[model samples]
Target: MTGSGARSVYIASAEGDTGKSTVALGVLELLAATGGRVGVFRPISRSEAGERDYILDLLLQFCSVDIPYEECIGVTYDEVHADPDAAIGEIVARYHAVAEHCDNVLVVGSDYTDVASPSELSYNARIAANLSSPIILVVKALDRDPAEVKAVADVLMADIKSSHASTVGIVANRCRPHRRTDVLDALRDTGVQAWALPEEPLLTAPTMAELREALDATLYSGDETLLDREALDVMVGGMTAEHILERLGESMVVIAPADRSDVLLALVNANSAAGFPQLAGIILNGGLRPHPMIDGLVRGLRPTLPILNCEHGTFETARIASHTRGRMATGSVRKIDAALTLMEQNVSQAELVGQLDLHAPEVMTPQMFEYQLLAQAKSDVQHIVLPEGGDDRILRATDRLLRRGVAKLTLLGNPDSVRRRASELGIDLADVDVIDPTESELIDEFADAYTELRKHKGMTRDRAVQVVRDESYFGTMMLHTGRVDGMVSGAVHTTAQTIRPAFEIIKTVPGVSTVSSVFFMCLADKVLAYGDCAVVPDPTAEELADIAISSAKTAEVFGIEPRVALLSYSTGGSGSGKDVEKVQQATELVRERADDLRVEGPIQYDAAVEPSVAATKMPDSDVAGRATVLIFPDLNTGNNTYKAVQRSAGAIAIGPVLQGLNKPMNDLSRGALVSDIVNTVAITAIQAQNLKNGK
Candidate 1:
């Protein structure tokens, strides 16, 4: 995480049981760890609903939040519903009062106790906007379909966007194991980072302490530790001894009349037996206690189970027990630990924290950059093809992309092998177009066209036929024939193998002689484009100029303002060499070609980025210290520098995104994760969109 240094970030959801507290606890811990004054503010308190609002207590227990509980929370839901305008004003006033003493604030959004409405999203978005904070939306995924989850998110996000609020990320908590992938798939391309949290049994199961509180039962016997066990199931003791013995199981809470001596003895004997599971506890119903003789006998037996005596009748006690669900209150160390662990494993700290504008100048964050790429790609979904469909990563990424509707896909592989593998991974690829190159009807036509296209280079028709059989060539043929808008390869293949077909078939766009590449370098608080990192080694001054121009345009296409920086060992004529001279000449050419581009030249990497360094080196340059598009003088320098920043700064480098191709095509790193592939495909889709626009 960059820093839990954000002043305030609202965690919002319209549905109940969103496991919002667990999400809030995780974000709270991060904010608390910042070692600054951190606070939690709930815009609407749940205390007025006859239930204690423990979220503030849970966060206030941290050593960093010194404010009292009353100061951190705003008015109640009833108050808000009564006077809408007055409620927002009170929430703002209360939130600012807390913020005045804190370095960071994590605002918990209001609960929608009423029926779901578009006004719910609007109301929360308005409050958060008034608080001057971005949002992290939470969605409940326990029993909902993936599409339903997406629908819920779409509704909220649309409202958030229209209300002029923004979300850095969305979390689907209580997501089922089988539905995890599907939830993520549905949530993708929402223009924010998304994660699916698996259901944690402990967080949802009722503990003895919770049941005792809810029932208002008096613990007549056994020590306090006995109350810590959970009631995984329930049983009634009005039945016979044989029936009670038959139902013996672990973590079972039995409700029996205080005088049911037979059933009590049977349960005790079964629990003592080697094969029987221990009981969670026993409840003595109807305000009755054990007989003197029975009590002596039970004391002599030395049982460890706790006994709670309830004033309510048997039916009422049983009903109360059945309806008690778990609540995470302060001082319950075990449940809190489980909730924190669930959040830590499921939520992405890096992605969520990276979106925070914790520092100065409100830099373009990685989340902003990624969301722009995904939104632009999905705005006009493009048809893309993958050559390495045999790879599991490709199949998994394809499932996600298809589910997200980011792009229509065609896979070049043997259908049986691809389907078999997809089935093993529980992925449904029924909608994807699978083309076996050997059996493809277009293979002969592709071979003939290829032979003609390369005939001037002494290509033979038989050789061209065999070359067209390769999946890479077959995919290139698809793009050349306009069957798909773009292609992404190189998961199992090398970079040269992936791009060679494109270079031969699609060639360069008009007026583009040199092929170059750029990596969107995602740093802690900002996203920068590092160019010529994967292509055109030792580029001439003219090629360098072209790379700079293309990189700036790519930056702009995805919403980054382009301030071009041409890097070298020197800073503004301070050093003289062939490298420096080439960079200086490239800078002049960039300014000549792009009269509107803000460019700084022959600058060291430090001077190009750090404001203090820029102030010392090139005080008057506009691009110095503020460049979003960095063009290295050569490929070796660009590649090594990007890798260095990626490793040393823990930045995400999404690229080797190839430019200058007439058709949109990209090469992936062989070690790419499924997420990496998804991002690259989206980048390619946006590139295809631009190419289609003839930009």
Candidate 2:
């Protein structure tokens, strides 16, 4: 099972003793041997020694993570007697944490009783629902007649294939050697995807050395000592700089003497090498002095590799490396390898999108599934509001989206005036809908509509009437009245002004308590959604919970299963006071109310992001280290923190997508360029669809 990146395989069972864990472990072992990052999570593990811990120990041998086991498994319940809902909550929390560290996670199932009682399986399915992981049902070949197997399989298949599941497949285990072909054919005939275990015994144990080699790096430094060579990609530095560049191209750790500038030059050259081979870092010999330039360059590229100044010279290091070669192929590759295998499984419509910003060219280019989804979405037209109507950039962008069958176009300006400007700018909008607020069918309607809606809200009829005449308010009203599906304004408005109309007329959806904004912060490896950066100046604990829940939902809508980290100065009871108390309370509230959400907070940004930092601080908290959704305490913290990460870390900030609105209407910054408008419009449209469906 091989692919470009990690893929996940979720495991369920038709009945107890189906051997889902054994199969999952086997797959994990196989894949982890191929230099893949694998992770495992049991959405429901009630066994005295939960299956998750077993898998965790196995994964630790191959992958690099310092998070404690308790944090990785959010809640541990009594094996025999425990509340299923409570168990599900803790399991989802833990599952999200593990899923964040790797590309794919193996979702293990709870126990399965007889087919006479489907509730047992149903409880496990609900946990999968909460985690939002794809599923693979494990069926026992023993004790099942053909009819019973098919019936049980059919029921499990339907349950796993509900709308909430991202994808699904099947694994049939331990078939009699002679009946294997017949059983496989029968299972395949059920129209459910399945994998049959081999008659030959499969070793499910993890081989550490194999994993080390798979990562294509040396065991210069690691937690374990039994370094395997096949799993080890030992980085050997030729005594010269040119060799370092040639051999280190995106490989692993490099060992050399510090006194050699030639070696330092080689170290520097290795980092800039084509594809930037994964240099674990330089292992300096004889504890020699490093050049200042080399030190600075290495510092510039930190966390990727660390310069280890050891007293041992090149000769001793080589001897250590030589001993590690044959042991690479030993560890279980289940989690990571399963993901790679599953990625190669070729499930239709399960597109693995790159973790980049929407503004990136790669995100916009239509892939097969995306093209089909967008094409089908064409019938669902949305009303788009552009602030500066006649600019070349705006018109060109609008034309491209329209030509691509994205949405029905609506330009906000006088038809004649816009026509004159479009002609001068050489932009064509011949068939686009051009509305002047002064003469708009919806604006005139919204002006009176706004007056009626806000008449009793401490505003006089004349005051409300005049306010509706304003562009922002009018634009928002059109969205509220269903005169338009959604609105995108603010090219000429500030955050307050653009959002004012929403606050005044549109307001929050009826049940929603707060209106918060989140910016989708995209990086090379992952996409994070940060909230309250553009709304809720200083939110209370209740408001913070609302923000976290809202942001989590938004992340789900964008194909990101959120691992929310509620950020603060402290982590996991590290600090005390009302501030920390607020965070703690909000975290509990989220766990209680938003049952499907995987959220943790009251953590520092470092603990929330860096696994190494998390290992040191709040090592037992599930949300520490691998959090994808970061919720800030107040606007001061949230706004400044996101901005800092963006500038300092070169993170791509997208959206600030306005949430808690009755309609999917968003405001752009006045300084928003044409591309920003395009992205905002896309996000607004998606939200509009979700709102209509009552999601």
lDDT of each: 0.81, 0.60
Lowest summed lDDT across 10 adjacent residues in model 1 is found at 359-368
Give the TM-score of each candidate.
0.57, 0.47
lDDT per residue for candidate 1 within 1-695, as digits (tens), equals 11233488899987788888889888876565433556788888877545668767776775254587888778887777788789999988888788877667889987676632348768888888877888999999998999999988988899898888888889988888889988999999687889888887667667777788888988866556658666768888878888887886666889998888787777766755655666777888888888889888887887656778888888999999988877777865546656766665676666767876543235444544554566578789999999999997898788767755688999989987787556434356778989999888897899999999999989998999899999999999999999999999999999889888988999987766778899999775578999999978899999999899888888887667999999998999899989999999999998898899898898999999999999999889888998889999888898899999999987879998888888889999999988789899999999999888977
Candidate 2 RMSD to the real structure: 21.0
lDDT of 2 at 261: 64
Please estimate how well model 1 matches the true structure, expressed as its whole-model Cα lDDT: 0.81
Candidate with the greatest TM-score versus the true structure: 1
Error of 1 at 555 (Å): 1.2
Off by over 4 Å in 1: 1-361
- Give candidates' CA RMSD values in order: 15.8, 21.0
Q: Positional deviation of 57 in candidate 1, in angstroms?
A: 20
Clashing pairs for predicted structure model 1, backbone only: none
Across 188-219, the per-residue lDDT of candidate 2 in tens digits comes to 77664655553222222223344333334343
Residue 171 miss distance in model 2 (angstroms): 40
- Report the Cα lDDT for residue 118, model 2: 35
